[model samples]
Target: MEITLLQGIIITIVIMIIVVDRHLEALFIFRPIIVCPIVGAILGDLNTGLLAGGIVELAFAGIAGIGGASVPEALLTSVMTVVFAHITGNDVATSLALAYPFGVLMQFTWTIRNTAFTAFNAPAERYAKEGNVKGLMKLCFYGIVITMIITGILTFLSVYAAQAPLKAFVEAMPDWVINGFQVAGGLLPAVGFAMLLRVTLKGKYVPYLLAGFLFATFIQIDNVLPVAIMGVAFALMEYYRSGEKEPVTIKGGEESGI
Candidate 1:
């Protein structure tokens, strides 16, 4: 699949914006939930984009760069999956499998980016020592620009140059191997859930967890929003309950005095 000039430009711009948002604003516009639709719209396939995005979002939900360590990158993964699905007319599972390597590659890129940014710290420290706020700000701005350029170039190369080889590789794989990829893709979300549980599971929160599981698994809620709303209500109740103070009881040993 060939990306036209206009498509390439749009994708590049989106990639740059996502990178800047990640580094500077951190407003989550770069998140798969938001970015997938935009990429789909660019490629004239919003439904596929949304589907791919949702799957990636769920699968990568627990992935975060915690304690200054880089995790598997999500933005590039989302972009690659949506674009692959859109161009090749593949299902979400296949897209996810194909994009996994790209995500790992981006983890490396993220670490390198951070390392590059760290180099400027010496200058920043010097500026700080001199009380030169403007110099420090300039260094920060330089880092932002470099980040955008690096991400943009990486994204463009992935979209434009790598697709043909990737498509060929997938086509050449045996049926069992391809199916294996799909199966792995389907199971990857469990990893995300396990990670999330590690952080959020606690004795006090078990009942709400059970409630949500029952609602989704047994009743088979058609839409997830209602279950999310129910969760919010439960959370609010727990919050208010925690705020309540126990009543004080005084021993009754004396008669009333006028």
Candidate 2:
């Protein structure tokens, strides 16, 4: 009943695919951290599940969906964090032993999946020409479903396959390895930040970005909750500032039109 890495991975995959395929909702809850704990709950490790999920969530605080892609690879991080957490006594920092690498691996998979989806869109357009909205949706839906299912299965199976190595690594890891992982923890935030830059960044928004970063780092805004407040405030200020009517200058530098 204690969800092993293999079973946890398996369940997480199924849930992830369902969310990704059916909902098209950014795969948020079905993410690795949430999925892990739910699996753990089913497996009688509720505490472990919750703890693992919380830790991964913090580490992935900056993760965001930009039109579609997410940076620092939330999916892989969530999944692997729970798995490693399960293996390593629910110590959040320790989970990074595999979570970071797993995230990188998932990034490759996601890029490949999206590329295939883009390619499929062309054929889907042909189907769309024939009044086949259903067909087009099917193309996108089934394609995503298939990809999710395959990744889910492979993730679970790979967990099992890698279990021995994971155990060995955890056991034999030098203190430096642990130290390195902890240090890697600080750097992980940069990944999400960089990815966010790629997604929401624009030329005029630099001040807001810097402000949010400063508030978060220096002003002690904790978690997504406070950040959301600050973001909303920032947005309101920007909106009103930009919405203010500007005066039109005439040839003599005087306002002409009201």
Candidate 3:
């Protein structure tokens, strides 16, 4: 599906909002899983958007930012991957594999944005010295605006210009390599889960984790929601069981004093 000018403008607006607006949980809205579908809807292909979103979301799920560090540029990558997949008639995996370079490119943009913001420090300090609270607020607001403009422009160009080049690249790829990407795409989510487990797994949760693995692997439960429901049930049972009062023991078989 080709992105029209109006659609491009809408998407640019959406990307800007997702990238810059965080006061109202913008991060949640813009996560690959959510943003991909919005992009797909813009391009008139919801299924491809949803598929690409879910795949990319899982693949990068464990890689969140730590302190001042950066995580994978999931927002932009998800948008581009879904756009590429929709336009090229390619599988979600192929689009995912192809989207990595853009993520790296976004990293550079992120660093540049941070560095650019430092230029505001002197002006901010001057405003503070003069007790111009409004000036400081305006400075911060403009900084955000500039950042959003930059993000919107990049997102527009990436989605609008990527269509032709991605099509050519996919067309020229060998069958074996394409198949390899598909397999890799299928397996990459597991790596994300492993990364997540590295940070989150504990001895107490291991049994529940093992049970989930058994349910999925042995029972062939491919859908995740059912496993999640089972986990919730287990947690509730544990909560109630932990709250139960221990049986009181009578001393010397004598009547307890009231």
Stretches of candidate 3 off by over 4 Å are 22-27, 220-222, 237-258
Q: Candidate 3 clash total?
A: 0
**What's the CA RMSD of model 2 in angstroms?**
6.4
lDDT of 3: 0.80
* Candidate 1 TM-score versus the reference: 0.89
Summed over model 2, clashes come to 2
Q: Can you write out model 1's per-residue Cα lDDT over 1-258, one digit (the tens) per residue?
A: 455668877988988988788775468888888888888889888888899889989988887777876788888888888877866667877888788888898889888878777789789889999999999889978988888888888888887767778778777889888788789889988878878877777655677878888889887566799899998998898789768984675554343321
Candidate 1 C-alpha error for residue 198, in Å: 0.8
TM-score for candidate 3, residues paired by index = 0.84
lDDT per residue as tens, model 2, 1-258: 134665655565655554473236654575546765775565566776677676666566657555675455655566566666666663656675457787677667777767776778778879978988888878867876767775776566545567667767776878788778767765665765665566567656777777777878877644667878978998898789868885674434232221
| Worst 10 contiguous positions by lDDT, candidate 3 | 249-258
Error of 2 at 48 (Å): 4.6
Q: Which ten residues in a row have the lowest lDDT in candidate 2?
A: 249-258
Sorting all predicted structures by lDDT, with the top scorer first, yields 1, 3, 2
Expressed as tens digits, the lDDT of each residue in 28-85 for candidate 3 is 7868898899999888889998999889999889866656576557778888888778
Relative to the true structure, candidate 2 reaches a TM of: 0.69
TM-score of every candidate relative to the true structure: 0.89, 0.69, 0.84
Error of 1 at 4 (Å): 2.7
Clashing pairs in 1: none
- Model 2 alpha-carbon miss at residue 28, Å: 3.5
Ranked by TM-score, the better of candidates 1 and 3 is: 1
